[model samples]
Structures are given as structure tokens and as C-alpha cells.
Target: MQHLLSRSWTFFIGLATGMMLTLAGSGLASKPQDSPAFQDAARIYSILQQIREFYVDEVAYDALVDDAISAIVSHLDRHSDYLDRNEFAHLTDVTSGEYAGVGMELAITEQEVTIVNLFPGSPALEAGVVAGDRVISVDGQLLADSDAETLLMGMRGPAGSLMHLTVQREGEPELLNFALERRQIDVKSVSQRMLNDATAYLKINSFTQTTPQEVATALKELALAPQLSGLILDLRDNPGGLLDSALEVADLFLDEGVIVKTRGRYYEANVIYFANTGEKISGISIAVLINGRSASAAEIVAGALQGNRRATVFGEQSFGKGSIQSLFPVQPGEGVLKLTTAHYFTPDGLAIDGKGITPDRFVPSQVVLESLLTPIINPLPLNTVVAYQGEKKIQIANQDNQLRTALQALDHPD
Candidate 1:
């Protein structure tokens, strides 16, 4: 999948031409040589050329240039990345909240590709793929030591194409192979259902550009249910997307409260986002589900709900990623830089850097539900209740256990 820059000089030249055209179209004259802006651009170009020609190893010039562009932006902060034309288009598709794929979220772990999450009703999920399963190979090619990005790219293809994957699951004697056909994955950001004909269950996968609208639609549907008792907002294994989307989603449930705030080196980056008037589900008990994989914008929503006591967070601690990245168009066509512009905080002013949103109840990954059941003679004909005694009270029986637990908790809130 690696393309050599020298071999693609035509592409590079075209990219450079496009950048020049964009600059010209802007109608802004080049700054004088004495200007700091001009000098900085010149210096960056010089470094890029030097590394391209004189780097000790045979580096991919295109990748080197992209990395150089990214390095410069990194000094600004963490959210930014250098994206070429293809990368930019792919990014756009993700934010658009729809694309064609097998419908699984993947991550690199210990140099092996792992299934981080599976979209409900996705082909992958229907094929019996589950989180924590290590992908051993793709299309019969060994994927050991391969980067997650590369592995994912290889697995993705046009609709109607097929991808073969070999996976290694924990405590399994044989490797599992699955043949998945590519299809358009319309990412459903929001899904709602009544947990027990009273409590509503809403699961938000990520906060994409359309997330706010999707959440609103789901909320409106759930609100139609009569005598709603409670709500379960599941953010488990959700990696954040759009910040604004997260803010809007929080606003749907919160009434007149600070959702989240951002703080950075610059004063301008320090600002607070507040929930406006109007509560979609006011005066309803709420419980939020989060895990170590819940990060970024997910943390924002969970933190806001927890801080305002709007919801009681349950499950393991969340992934501590509080930094906000702002995309800056550095050199259009050549690449764009994503920079970490700010650090976000909860409504109660709790920092979320290394400290993720701690759940009100800590549920561990072991201890089966069988241990929670108590023998009852003539058990009362009432809804059963189970609470996590400690970290080891719950067990990871399967990939669906987390969701099952969340549903159970919402049904019988202690």
C-alpha cells in the first residue's frame, strides 16, 4: 500500500500546481520576504527538500513531506494531521456519517489489528465478529506487525467486493476465518428502544456532523413512548468525532447548564459550551454507560451528564483523551495540518486529560452473572435487580455483556 513519492512525481507536481492555483484564487499577494510568514514557509520548504534528498535512509519522499507538515502542526497542538487528497476525502466521508464498509471499528493493539467495536446489525456483527478479537490476517495475507490504518485500508473495498479475515480469539484453539462482503455502511449514530416498555435505551456510536440531527430524531421517537421511566445513554467503546455534535447531543438532555469547556495556551481557546433552554427528556432518570474505549467527544457528553447529575455513569473508567484538535489548511492539495488546539473540561470544571470520567459504579471484566443470582423461595413477581458488588462483580461472558448489563441496570436502578 506504500507509494513511492519519486515514482509519483506527476502526482506531486499536480498537487503543487493545485496549491499554487488555490493561493492565486485567494487574490492575496505573497507577503514580502521580510515577513515572518514568508520566512517560515521558506524555512519549512527548505527542511522538506533537505530531508527528501539527504535523509540517511531511503525514505518515501511523499510520506516524509507529509510527516514534516504534520510535525510543524504538532507543535501547535494534538488534533491535527497531514492529509493528502485521498486522506481528506476519506475524512470527509467519515464525518458525513455514512460510507461503504463491513461496519466495524478497528484499532491497533500490540502491533496486531483488533476489533474495537462492532456496529449493531452490521455485516461484521452478523458474521459473528466481536470486539477484542485479534485479526490475524486479511485476504490471506499475514497482518502481524502491521499498522491498524494499513490493515483497515486493506480490508476496505468497493461494494460487492469480498474481504477474507482470519481472527484469533482469546481461549480458542483454532483461528476463525470470515469472508465479509463489502457494502455501504450507513452509520446509524443513534438508536433508541424502550428498555422495558418504560425506560428508554439510546446508544450513540460517535458524534459525527449529522449526529445532532440523528440524536434529535431518536429522542423525538423515544419521547412518544408513554410514561417513560428512565434513559440509558450508552457511550461504550465510542471514539469521539465532531465537538459541536457532542455539544448539541448533550444540550438535548441537559437544561441550562454548562456542557463542557476548553482551555489552551491561548486565551481565545478557553471557552465554555452551555446547554440552551428546552429539555427533550426532562425529569427522567438517566444512566450513562462508558468504558475505557469511550474517548474525546464521548467523554464530553459523559462528563457533562455526570457532572450535572443528569445521569449516573456506570462501567469501567473511560479512555482519557481530553485534547481538542483543530484542522488548519496549511498547504491545500499538498496536505492539511490537524493541531491540538485545546484541552476540554467537564461542566463541574474537572480536567479530562489523564483522568477520564469515572463511573459511579465500577464494573470489572470478570465475575459472571450467575454469581449475582440469589436463590429465592417464592420469588416476588417483580423486576429483578442486580448491582455490581465490586470491580469483580460482573464478567465479560461475551461481547454483548456490557450492553446487557447497562440494560439491566437501567431496569432496576438502585
Candidate 2:
């Protein structure tokens, strides 16, 4: 009881003083100590003290402090959050592009955890767990009502830990069961494939610490230096990641120009990023594909490329999440506070906070391609899916109209 009261008093006193200083800094220095802001601060402390002393049941002081901090920070914006220890760890794992898990990219579809993609050489891939599989449970825990964060926490653990997964695959007679061992899953941020002899298609899942390097390496592997005619950079369904990674990726395509700018109350936040000299692959016509899911760092790259006329953006308007979040560590071994620090602007000086970036050409969702092209008889075999439009045949994993249109545009540039 003594320890709790003493700590609580200290916390409330410090909080009251901080509030007063903030009020003073905001041109209210001449106000009396009994001002509304001061009274509110005192009221908060009094309420907390009362709750601690006279509550119906025992309460955790740490939980109360955490809840107070969360309430204060989260009300600022939708992007800001008070990350708990687990949430902070998850953020680190994502930005680092590495974690101990089965290595399956998952999405919530109709309240079920569905596999979207798999990393190469991952435990999930080796176990024949393909995309479109729905994970019903993890280690005997039913994930029916779990959100993304809970699903991730349940999946990830110490390396070499054994895990069991129950999955529901389409056309399966019964639910598939698999026993897998957790391993270090190094997610590839960038994946590439050739659209044709001269065109290359690169899909970026998310920006991470290794994103720029992965992109550079993919370009090198394409070996299209002398013969490269066109490039398609796909940011479809990407939720975005680190801002620095986005800047570096944009730098690879731009010779020299202002990539993006940020504005905030602090001078440190108000800065501009400029591309360095030279392009990684010069003189190649570029097409960028974005959708409603593309945001933050993803939008940054698309806006930079589009504004500089280095690439033509297609598909749809990007997700408007242009606010910058900076992590402030609360204390050692505690959690961090993710605060919205600034609003970012495109190279054209346009803010995309609420209004997203409009594409140069709007392309609708997947199409049958029957009206636009002449139907040809399947020469390979039955049950083989192939994307064909007009006289050109583009081999794709799936029938994506945006990609098909982008390829056509790049093939015959306007």
C-alpha cells in the first residue's frame, strides 16, 4: 500500500507539472494555477488516487498507468497507438522482415485467417501449405475470433518450437493437419519475374530494412541492363513499412529530385528527401501498379515516381495513410508509444492524408478479357490457366487486369 501510494503520488505530481508546462508553452503562461487545464490535471490525479484507494476490487497500478497513457496517445489520431510489449515486438519483427514462425503471409477473409503468400524455403512451403489455405487453429487454440495481432502472436515463438496447424483448403474432403517446426523466417520484401524478353515485373510486399537491397539485387538478377525495355513495379495490396526504405527504393529509379517532404510542429520532422544522382536502370519505361491497400511508404514511392514522370501509376487510388509515426520508448522493458509526428507530402507538394493519389490511368479489377481480345484455343492442355488478351499472351500466376493493362501500355508506350 505504501509503495503504491508513493509511486502514484510521484506520477501524478510529475504529470501535473508537465501539463502546466505544456499549457505555459502554448501561450497560456499568464494563466493562474486554478485554470481549467490545471484543474483537469488535478482531477485526473485525484480520480486515479481514488480508484486506487477506494475501488471495489484490487487493481494493478501498472495497468492503470498504461491505460491512462494509451487513452492520452490513441485519442490523438487513428495512426497513433500505445504499443504494449507484444505489439512493440511485433512491429520490430515486421520492420526487420524476420521472425520465428512457419513463414506464411496471412490475411483475414470473412473472419478467418487465410494464407496469402509463403516465403521461399519456409516451413509452411515445405509442408505443402499453399496459398488459399485457411488456418482454423494453431496449436489447439481456435482462431475463429482472433484478429491479426492475436494470430501473429499465436504463430510466432522461439525458433525450433513445434507447432500444429489445422487448415481448410478448397476442394479438400477434410481439414488438413500439419505438424511444423518454427524457424527463422526471413521474408523477402521484393519478388521479381520477367513479363517478357524485355519487360520485368517486380512485386513489393512491404518496405523493410532490407527492401532497398532486395530490390537492387532483383534488378541485377533480371540481367536486363542492355536489353531492358520496360519495368513494372507492383505495389498492389502492400500496407507499406519504413519511410527510409521507401526513400531508398524511390532513389533507385530517380536520377535526382525531391522525393517526398514531411511537415510537423518540430523542426526535426519538417524535412525533405531528395534522390541521389544516377538511376539503377536508365532509359527503361516504368509502370507502377497500386491499389487501395497501398499506403504510407508504398504511396511515397508511387507518388515520387509518378510526380517525377519516371513511372506511370496505374490501378487505383492509394490508401491515404500519409501520417508519420515515431516510436518513443516509454521505459526499459516496458512498451513504446507510437505517436503520429508529422504529415507527409508527395513530390508535387500534395498531401495525401485523407485524399489518396490518383493514378495516371484508372484500371478496374480483374476482367475476363473476352471483349478486348480474340479467344484462342488452349494449345498446352486442359486445366491450365493462362492470361491472354488481343494477340499477345502474358503468362501470369493469376488473371490480373491491372497488370495486363500495364504490360500493354509498356509494350506500346504512348
Best by lDDT: 2
lDDT of 2 by residue, 139-172 (tens): 8877765644455466667888888988999979
lDDT assessment of candidate 1: 0.67
Candidate 1 at residue 360, lDDT? 88
Model 1 residue runs over 4 Å out of place are 1-32, 35-44, 47-64, 70-80, 109-112, 369-414
Q: What are the models' TM-scores? A: 0.78, 0.76
Model 1 residue 29 CA deviation (Å) reads 11
lDDT for model 2 comes to 0.70
lDDT tens string, model 1, 1-414?
000000000010001000100011222357999999899888988987887788888778777776666666557522344566665555556666677778876644345656766777777899998888887888887876564444555665688888887899996999999988878877777887776677788988776668799889988898888888788898886767667778789999898889998887866668888899998888788888888877777888899988988888888998777876554554556544444557788988988877888998887633334454444322112334454656646322323445556666666777
Show where candidate 2 strays beyond 4 Å: 1-50, 53-56, 106-116, 125-151, 162-180, 223-225, 369-398
Give per-candidate clash totals: 8, 0
lDDT of 1 at 15: 14
